[model samples]
Target: MQRKWMFTFILLVVGFMVAVQYNTVQQPSERDTRDIWAIRNELAKERKLHSELLTEVRALDETLDKYNASEEGNKGQALLETVEDLRQQAGITEQSGPGIVIDVVPSQESVAMGTPLHEISPELLTRFVNEVNRFKGLDMDIDGKRVTALSAIRDINGQTTVNGLPVTIPPFQIKILSPDIEKSEKLYNFLQSSSILDDFYLDDFILEINEPENNVKINGRSDQSENRYLKELPKGG
Candidate 1:
């Protein structure tokens, strides 16, 4: 009986030691897992913070560039250039450049008929304007009236009107300003060539082209309306 009781006490002691060893090993594993998880969370946060900082740095750089461009001396020049460009495009300022003047008159043969050739058709005039525009001709005028992109060309009561002005005369003056002299000469030749002249019955019309030695003056219009859909682009776009 005494031996049995001692053996039972020994077994209880061994069981308690095993349990303590198992608990010690498992506790360290759990703690190690928790530490790795915390480290991963810290790295993720740092990555997010780095991305945010990069975005802010780029924005600040753009702001600095804009500020430098808008400095006192540079600002005035930049604004002047921008305004001049806009004025030129809008035809709000007089331009002096190398260009051509064309005088169109009704041929005697067509005038004898006195039906279709009494006055030039608005369709033909519009086609001519479109061709000149295609060749990058700037600051156009028809019979002393400014021709703009917004100008209306339509027939009214057996007569053609440009921007609501009468153009029923036998001879019409068309003035065009080109940026280059060579281009103006090319356009003049093209207008007289068979490819363009033969497109219509221009044989019933007399077209005379002349290029001035000095600069040709072109007038501007004050009635241009502002665009409604013009908007600035967003930053970084």
Candidate 2:
């Protein structure tokens, strides 16, 4: 009986040891499963971060594209405005403003005396134009022909010509534009007391200055010929 009791105690001890070993093995598998879940969570976070970075990069690219387009558009608009301004400065565009009209006619005395009307001298017209320019004439025209910086006033074959075009006889109009009404009034006042009138009288011509009128139009140059001597220079030359 004593031997059987000892044997039973030994079997119980062995069974407890086996149970502890089995529990240790099972705990390792459960821990490994938890570790795998943790690793998957970390991978998911990394993937989400990568996706957000890609989205931000794409947004930045789109913004950059929009900025480039806007910059190009602004450049184009600036170029157009510059071209228009140049056209205006070159007197290639029609201008209208408050100004005065000058009528050139034979003097009443000369007409009454039955004296033949003489053709206007180029020097007189040139001097008159210079005086008008000095008095703030922004634009001018002679008998409907636009006078520009490049216009040539001279005698061609005994006929007075402006920009190679013939000027009409006496009674032709000389239209001048001022920047504003105030300048127009100033010009009118100056002309009324100017010595240029005496010069006209000496030549048997009447320089009649009219009151300032609004909406005075001066046409642009009809000739579109470019200057043959003016050429664009090469870059870096």
Candidate 3:
């Protein structure tokens, strides 16, 4: 998961860097369009891989839940308790705690109804999502959706169009769970330091954790690769 985050960040940075210089360095006119297409293709491929991994993770979690339930009084009971606590607190009847809500808006809030398709670019969206992920406990998905490992970088799944309805493009609205105000602010500030924040109006963000909770769940990934990777590393020998 950590590797994927870094990979995604690098991809986003590259995309933005290209977008920044797309027109200025107008020397190679013929290959310009082709190069842009190649970058977008790479982004799509990464999204597909992430999606596949996410599905695997979700399936593994289901299996763990079933096994945990059967072993009622086993040694893993404490772990089960933690999972249950996280789920309930993440969202249930009610949750009273400090959480951050990031509101992402288009470059122009009022882009006239009939504005052309090329009005906003994808790099803007990538930056907004990256900004949210910079925080220790914060991550996001499109609106209420949870970002699984396989979430796509671009809305279309490498397809030009599907069935009629269009895919989502960012300017994403992110909701994050942040326990500490100071740390959360630090993360937000770091994001603003980057030029992406300047491109959009971000006053809509609200960090409301006044109703703090005594406990917050730590819902971890179901992948065993983490353990394997660490065990195989140099220090493990």
Top TM-score: which candidate number?
2
The order of the candidates by TM-score, greatest first, is 2, 1, 3
Worst 10 residues of 2 by lDDT: 27-36
Rank by lDDT, descending?
A: 2, 1, 3
What tens digits encode model 1's per-residue C-alpha lDDT throughout 1-237?
999999999999999999999999877655545587799999998997798799879966865575577978787676676668667777777777888888777776777878465666788778878877757446788877678888888987777888777775668777888878888888777777735454445647776677543477767764555679988899989
Pairs that collide, model 3: 50-150, 51-150, 98-209
Write the residue-wise lDDT of candidate 2 on 58-163 in tens digits.
9668655655666765866755765676687667888888999999999999999999978899999999888887653378999777887778899999999987
- Taking all chains together, each candidate's TM-score versus the true structure is 0.57, 0.64, 0.38
Cα lDDT listed for each candidate: 0.75, 0.85, 0.50
TM match of model 2 to true structure: 0.64
lDDT per residue for candidate 3 within 1-237, as digits (tens), equals 999999999999999999769865765556545687899998998997798799879967976776666656673765666567655434322332344555544445445444333322334455556656545455333444444333444535442221222334434344545667665566556654665555554422222222322333323322222233434447755
Candidate 2 local accuracy as lDDT?
Answer: 0.85
